[model samples]
Target: MNTNRTPNPPRGDGHAHGFLGERAELVSALLALTVYLTGLILELTGNGGPATLPLFVAAYVFGGFFTLREALLTVRRGRFQVDFLMLIAAAGAAAIGKWEEGAVLLVLFSLGHALEGYAMGRARRSIEALGELAPRSALVLRAATPVEVPVEELVVGDTVLVRPHTRVPADGFVASGTGSLDQSAITGESIPVDKQPVADRAAALADPAAVDAGSRVFAGTVNGAGALDVVVTRLARDNTLARVVRMVQEAEERTSPTQRFTDRFQKVFVPGVLALVAVLLGIGALTGEPFADTFYRAMAVLVAASPCALAIATPAAVLSAVGRAARGGVLVKGGAPLEEFGRLRTIAFDKTGTLTEGRPRLTEAEAADGVGPQELLRTALAVQRLSDHPLAQAVVRDAPALLGAAPARSAEPAAVNLRAVIGRGVTAELDGEEVHIGSLAYADSLAGPPVPAALRERTRQLAESGRTTMLVRRGERYLGTLGLMDAPRPDAADTVAELRGLGVTRMVMLSGDDQRVADEVGRAVGMDEVRGGLMPQDKVTEVARLRAAERTAMIGDGVNDAPAMAGATVGVAMGAAGSAVALETADIALMSDDLRRLPFITGLSRRAGRIIRQNLWLSLGIVAVLVPATVMGMGIGPAVLVHEGSTLIVVANALRLLRYPDVREARARR
Candidate 1:
């Protein structure tokens, strides 16, 4: 969730004047302390009288003058804030001749407010740290000379030079350099991305460009070990960093379910407290108690049962929990999303780019005919070297190293004749000899002869086991078979086990891949069910179906997963490799692309929810006990003490949710 607050200019005339004002507040606090001490000394010396009353009054005035002023302003503006309640409680204490109680109430309430302010300030500072990661200026190249300029001065189509170790100034395409880029600041991937000039061209040609020289890069990402000249494609304010800031702000603005319930409860709760105070006063007056005693009792009841503790409990817990989540690389969209996580019974995950590594890998290669194994390997590598598909690249990567020098690099294979049969293989001429690589169907169609029974059976076995088998042939002769598969990520099994331990009972793998691939990966990762060959909308329908059974979370990292992610009870996005739609749509973003964080965040959310419930109960229980006792002739001093103590307990309990040591350690262990 976005924790960013709107930027406000510092509220000081100047640095010196600001310091002076802070000193003045300090002086006021010290003066109030002295007055409180003087009153206590007078009481201890057996001289408690009108003089002591004046000292107590002086303590209240000095400590709470600003609070009272603000309270009055809010009242004039037709708003009733918590400060107004404190002011009323303090004034009532004095009116009841409880000078010590009034002094204590003012001093303690002021201190609590100050402490809350300090905590909020610290939280704001942590959020601001994210904004500071982006550089303020860009080094633009003009006439072959580099000129440093403010980032705001950059525009679309302008070329800027980024040096090693500096944050990229804007979202842009690299013009003429290759390097590694660290996108952890934006996507939370730990590995630095290797970029090349050729890769950049291919990426740019793709609707969404790849990371390479001349490929677009975002602000706040770091360039590693190389200098790059980039053509700015997006203004500074419209870059990925800015979008993150915007998303966070929007998330924060969206009210959580808990907040809505609390707000509705308060609308009735405040009036109920007021009615109870009136009833107590009426009963006391009818009993013929002194007017002063009845008034004191009534006001004490109001102070004892204000429900302020309840007001602060849930929000404080949510704020603290969200802050801790941010530090741990999870962005919970809002308190509602965090609360929903604890209720999840089933989690549906996208297979490609989520449960399994999105990339395909070469698993096995076997010669089918008398053709030598080395010849088949060489032929496969030569043909695949000209293609950029992930499967083709995987095949080339798996080829054995040659004896000495690297194979000659070619822009494209040069051959007298070439043919590509989709879903099968390709045939081409190399040094005037016929060469081919592809599937069995394409090979048999070309040969028009009896198919080899052994090769067909092997291909069937591989296909049934979720492997893509490619047949290589030359002219009318069969060569060999190549096995390719989209393997499960190494960490997938451990992450699934962790989620099970965290109470996720039903885990389903959903993918657009074939059922064979889905079943294979699902079994490896311990998923309870597998649904494959699903389009984006189909995934959404499945998520909705799961939600009917119980609360469901959808975890994914691609455009196809966007709708399903949004439809789940709590959407989790793998920040790294996640499409823009998925990142923006998911309720929570796992910044590090590590599924292990899923269980850790789930544990944290459950713990936070429990803490919130405990705080709510504690605050209500305290009021239930204290209000009745105060009505039964308890003194104002004791009642105020109990009320203030309960508030402190609630605040302290709420703050404990911010202790994230265990959450961090959990992720580390995973």
Candidate 2:
């Protein structure tokens, strides 16, 4: 969101013009003024006089010369566009001695085209701003000193230091430091992630091993309070941000079916109108009507039947909607993607960072006899202090009131017999007593007795509620239990309901977490289906399956979710906590990580699309009404006025999409 990136000013020397090209607005305004003044002078003189004809010719040249040239070139290339129709209609009017009418037509059409171009340019600029999200430079570690270098200069195996408050330069892992990282830019989760060194090998896991470090972190994520020495893995060109830009560019290149259909319709429609006008003139001549009257009427019919309104309708609305979405912090890749959003009947969301907070929190605690909950919490906090596990950290954070001024140091080795059971918990001995902390089943087995009904019920309830339950014991004696939960995001339920209201019929939750956890979250957020315990590849497969069934939208915030996001009909990324891969892979990015905005955007897109269709129909209807009326000996003047006026009305109606009411409401809620 760096809105203040100074625009490159147009150069006066004209060696090369910048994007603005020296205030196109001023040039257009001057042209409009000239046309208006000339029209006024012609009206003050006699309307059908030779003196007014030259002024009309000048106005026509000034207003539509470029359009005419372009249209001719396109026609020669076998691409008969809507612009060609406008040029032909203006030329036909001039040939029939309706010079004033021709000039007015050119002026109106040129103004509409210029306005559409400006709207499209604004949309393109907004999309380009998204390309600026990644930082250009990175701090690389050479020998023992850190050096600032362009991100592209860094390569695989090169050590880079990412300090607190700085974006990670490229995808890599933590080499020798421990700290929290706010990966919201990549993952869309609001919470920060804690990083630790991989502990499987020694030499292979050197204090600064390149391979392991290169496999963990991602670009565009923020390093927190701790410093990390990372090895660059991906090249700048292959980074997530670059991939997203490429995808959007590709999408832009593909034309929508609607646009193609309109083109076909215009080709046939224009020729048919000309034939009808010719037949009408032939009938008038056969019936012995005035020849001049019949010819003028036929020209009117030709002018009126040109599909000017239909041509402007769709593109204008698309430009407006895209602009509105960008201003609201959603980066919709293009008009087609925006249109697809309106058709989304089913939406599948990733669990860790989609429906839930994606961060662990303490949910339950129990105490042993003689050892109060506070005492047990203090010991657990002391032991977990050295670990970077999110669950352990959550427990430590929840019991801060129980911790004394002289906090237990995790750096201090626990009493003898300290051991961590994989996928269970930790165990240690303190003060000559053997302490066991693990799953309820593990503790019950060690205790060698039927578990108490109360403890069993408590454990089952916690487990079913999607909590990670840990049992604390003293040797063969059961002491207490702890429960941790990754709670649902506060707005998750409301967002799901709103999406449903917006015509999203089916919603699914997809996650890498366990089935029970995913199911619990799914129910909480009103998901219609739940798929869990999936790897990155599995997510891609699931999305493919969903696509086979119906058009699907995948919402996620993890590096693991990238493939699935790309595979879905429409992909939405949580901008705040999403991984760089997810952000760059998604078709649309919710920049602020507010899920509520999803429904609002979908609604706006639907409304915009409807308005576009209405404008098209209205434009066609005007042509349909005017063409028949003019061909039956009606005057050319009124027909020309109606045609130009209808085009202006359609263009203005389409532009109304730029100010969607739902966008304002969504922002107000924020």
**Per-model TM-score versus the true fold:** 0.87, 0.75
RMSD of 1: 4.6
List RMSD in Å for every model shown.
Answer: 4.6, 6.9
| Per-residue accuracy of model 1 over 1-670 as CA lDDT, tens digit each | 2333432111111111123334555466567778898999989999887788889889898878756766676567665555666677678768777778778767765554444444444544454565667889889987879899998999876778889888888877676788988875665444576655444543553444344322557788899989998777667776766766565544545556766776677667766777787887788789998877887777777767766667667766776676666656577777789888977779999998778777788887877867777766777777776666677788887765531244565633454455666767676776666777666666667645545888888888888888888887655666778888888989899888888888889999998889998898899899999998998889999999999989999998735677888888888888532245655777888865577678768888988888878878887898889888878877656765676576667667767766755543454447
CA lDDT of every candidate: 0.71, 0.67
Q: Model 2, 1-670: lDDT tens per residue?
A: 2232222111011111224622363255348548655765767875635656666777777667556655766667675565666666677777777777667767765665555445445544554554566679988877778889998898877888888778888866666788877654443334566777555324433432233322367677777888787766568787655554444444444444555577678778867876786797799999998775666667667767777677666655665676566545455666667778777798889888678877888767766445577656656665566456777788768757544463546543355556777777777776677776667767766645555567777888889888898876654555567888888999899888888877899998888888998888889889999998988899899999999999899888735577888899988887522244445566777755567668767887788778777887898899879877876655555765676677667667766766676543445446
